[model samples]
Target: MSGMQDRSWWGREARATVALAYPLVLTNLAQALIPATDVVLLGWAGPKVLAAGSLGVNLYNACMIFGVGVMIAASPMMARALGQRAHNVRDVRRTVRQSLWAAVALVIPIWLLLWHSEGILLLFRQEPELAKQASHLIRPMMFGMLPLFVYQVLKSFVSALERPGWAFAAGAFAVFSNAILNYALIFGKFGLPALGLYGAGLGSTISNSVMAVGLAIVVTRHRHFRRYYLFGNFWRPDWARFAQVWRLGLPIAVTLGMEVTIFNAAVFLMGMIGEPELAAHAVAIQIASLCFMVPLGIGQATTVRVGLAYGRHDRVGVGRAGWAAFGVTMVFMVCSASLMLLAPRFLVGLFLDVHTPANAHVIDLAVAFLTVAALFQLVDGAQAVGAGMLRGIHDTAVPMLFAALGYWVIGFGTAILFAFHLGWGGIGVWVGLAAGLAAAAVLMMTRWMRREKLGLI
Candidate 1:
């Protein structure tokens, strides 16, 4: 292809990816707001409540991220099925059906484990009271798991269909509903009892159920989705597809879990260092996560776009989809990194009262963390989009190995060395994080570049 034609083709794919990604990005932001609200409400309840709530929320999210990974398998599968033929309704519906089945299968054992979350926390030497209080949040929060997973399956369905607007609509409503319900129940406002952390958990539970059901209604009634008969013979089983989901999903789950748990581990490490460090780590990581939702959303879109091309055996199209996402992700990461570098204090101010004298040290540490965080933003976005690119081609096991090696072996090991032995403290942990992300980015992107040689296409 000529230079002009190549530029034009890449530009079109980039535009197409952004068009597909923005709603999903908004949806991720909406979902993020629910927890941010909880944190705010828990802060108002008390320091102890906030501590317990954070612990509980972290535990809940670790499990939820894993299950969502499993549910996400349906996205690429459906995309590929549809790309192979525009109306592979049977395969699409079957994929969704078994994804729901997989959700159920995964959630049961998880629920049993979570029911004993207090015991688990206790085993880790957490304070007994904190563990007990966290359980109050965990038990109620666990009830939301299946519903949230259901919502995830539906979300993947819409994303595969490239009609993500309704899912975003439903997520926005859920965010609003969650805030109101948590406010009422937590403070005993509007005739609700002051149940504190439990109220927060219960509020989220109800909101998730509503979101799932609302999307289900859309799937059934909307002319665009109705032809699939997604719920017809809901009891029938498809073991083959069920197995396929697990085959693809277990690795995805482990990959995501490694990524999530590494951050979670950073918190524990921060705790041992000092309250100010822990507090600062929380602030910096939250900001990074919010920024991360952008590339993460773009990555999800890349999965669909590339999966579709792969399904059609359009190798050039697959390259286009993957490279387009990579280019867009790098551009966004550059912008976000610049923001983090330019206004660390300003960003920290959003999370804490920077003017307060007592918060000075914490704010200072947070600013420092954000500086290192700024450094990692590029690699973080690259690895995320790179993983999505590989997932599009239905290659996961090796990437899972890459994630474990990069995130844990290199990342966490470096964190331990830098934070403790070398005495770099919190900054060391951030360095370790950067190292991990950098390694993962290099490995995943290299794999993507060699897709043709590796037979991934």
Candidate 2:
């Protein structure tokens, strides 16, 4: 009986982690696919469109990161609740409903900001043509803001409950719809008007809306979730719970903003060098983002597992979950880095038309940038995993400080010095970034280890 209990518990952790992480990885991949497809399809529209789309997407992405971070607070809280089995069905239903309403509140302002993106871009003094194109892309994509926000809220709830297959199915559906829309709208296939870069934005918006509604339907219909949907009771706002959400989510939101701003600052600095350099930086960032999904997926699992284990006072389980995620992330990073190093040109060529005259310099620069990118993956993976582990312990504030100091003070400062004072150019800036990430990795890992020794994790 003891052996059987041990086996069952082991199976639960393994199955739960894998089930959550697999769908998350797939969803991350699908999210990446949208931009990957955009880069390919927009190539036909010329360099200006590509540049505009890149800038607009980067801007939007930076803003969205804050929302994503805020939403993550929900998962840990929900996971803890599930672990303790403290909440009744009605309570769970109320929490989920309130969360959705909170999401709606958060999304509205962001959508408004997106609508006024043209004014924001004007402040940058970007090339007029590029700004116009960016405005076009931004406008259509704004429609997706609410849907994406709503989906994320639901996703957090599902993942926390260890039901990630539903989220994966939703992501799959969105990807399929996005692909079809991109082909039809970008190229004017099957009698659709060719909207070029605008089409890509529209396609994303439509796909997000579909995914949000579809997932909502599925969740509402499911036996586990149906009990949580108390019509009149669920609709009312609970100020106390909302305040708790805000308290937990706000710091995460701020941390995300700072991190994304640091990256955006880097991108802006890259643009000052020239279009080719900017494009190269974009390529490297994209490749890194793809590699990042592994840590991200594992991180989600870690957060859930840790939260659950902590609530149960299962210290060993928490430690194991954190280590399992870290190990998996490291292995994935190594493989991803290998692929990037081995076929730098091939990877760049997949996005940019290498043979084209306008793209020749961009392709060459991308290949060069990716070489520097390859070395940073190990440190990046380490830092991400360490942060994930920390999050599992509900220790967010210090990690946020670490990120700000490391990325801004060390990373950006080093880049400015190396890029300008030392005449090291783009490679110098990348090296600075590597240094920052490596420092962050070391510091975070040390902190996590100390916390573990204290029995905090």
Candidate 3:
């Protein structure tokens, strides 16, 4: 019965694809809500608070994205193992434990270094008040790093087992929890003292902690996971498995870090332009992020599907998964971009009080950035899906190199020229970013196709 169920789970291409993609899509959307909820709560405080939250969240994302990349390496490895029917529950649990250790090793230095974030913020020469508020928000958020990593590791484990709904549920719970806490804490409601912006950070930290613990509990209780859990020793780390994960994870870590650095550089450049431009960039980034969730989810699905295909030595299945995911992502991106371009003001207004005195200029800038954003979503979606497909093949090194070149050499270089040399401002920076993503999309897809033809995938 177990064998039959496992076979049925991975046998049908379309059904399995949807099963994998839907949960991931929901999970990604829910993850996006964490920051969106923070922004909404802080927006009620005023523009300065919103700006500060934006800055702090961007910094947090910049740090965490690389950690996500490290975690991403696990899903493909696990998926391939499962597909080959060689994966043990004990080994999976061991990997999870080691990943937690890795997360701790990585985050501690980051936390200590960021203790002096005010100095880092000064590099952008941002408003002193905004900088101070951002630091306050950032410090508390850092405490949640370990919990966030644990949540991600569990999510990756669930995704590898082709049971992505568990991750989706965990993320949804976190999102709802965050929203309620933000309301209660931000406004001093339900007899709780209002912590204001600090409360917003606290809400996020608590939500992440809950998510981590909840997922750990649920996964441990699961029949599938029970087969893997050792009854007596839970804390023992497997050095060999840790090394394997690190070998697969390092390239992805560097790739994600480079990609995020390019965007952070763009944010810093926007800050140099002025407060309104920075705020507008923030709004545009949020809108773009919402659109991006679809591709990210599709990419995750592709990774699992492709990895499984590779494990089964089904070259055609790998190719089909890659193409299907890319096509689906493209369609979603087109519709999302069209909607945003058609009604930029209405969308921006949903998050920011456009009618307010402090936000009028920000709205105008956001509209302009949204216009540019519309053109880039297609390429961005394509590249992300392509990267996912490659990850399934365990082809991390070349993809990492491509990402580095695409973002740093091509994307940042073009942005610097446009923003400074050509005097195009934020619009130029966005256009350059679009070009970089386009380059990545074309290169990555071509590489995957070639590899497929050679039976490498």
Candidate 2 worst ten-residue window by lDDT? 86-95
Alpha carbon deviation, residue 427, candidate 3 (Å):
1.2
Task: Give the TM-scores of the predictions, in the order they appear.
Answer: 0.96, 0.92, 0.93
Candidate 2: tens digits of C-alpha lDDT, residues 1-457:
9989876766666666666788888777776776666766776667666777877777788777787777777777777777778544555565566666677778778888887777776676666666678778878877787787778778877777778778778878898899899878888998999998788899989998998888888778998766666334656778877776677776777766776776676776676666767677777778777778777787877888888887787887887677767777788888888988999998888777777887888888788888888988888888877877777777888888888888888888988888778987777778778878887788888888788576565
Give the runs in model 2 whose Cα sits over 4 Å from its true position: 1-16, 86-88, 230-232, 452-457
lDDT of 2: 0.77
CA shift at 263, candidate 1, in angstroms?
0.8
Q: Model 3, which residues run further than 4 Å from truth?
A: 1-12, 230-232, 452-455
Candidate numbers sorted by TM-score from highest down? 1, 3, 2
TM-score of 3: 0.93
**What tens-digit string does per-residue lDDT give for candidate 1 at 1-457?**
6999999999999999999999888888877777777876775564456666767777788898999899989988999999999989999999999999999999999899999989977776666787788898889878898998998899889999999988999999999999999999889999889998889989999998988999999999999999999988888988999999999988989999899888877877776687678667767887898899899999999999999999999999999999999999999999999999999999887767777887788789999999999999999999999999999999989999999999999999999999999999999999999999999999999999999999888
User: How does candidate 3 score on lDDT?
Assistant: 0.82
lDDT of each: 0.89, 0.77, 0.82
Clash pairs, model 1 backbone:
none
Give the clash count for model 3.
0
Q: Show the lowest summed lDDT stretch of 10 residues, model 1.
A: 43-52
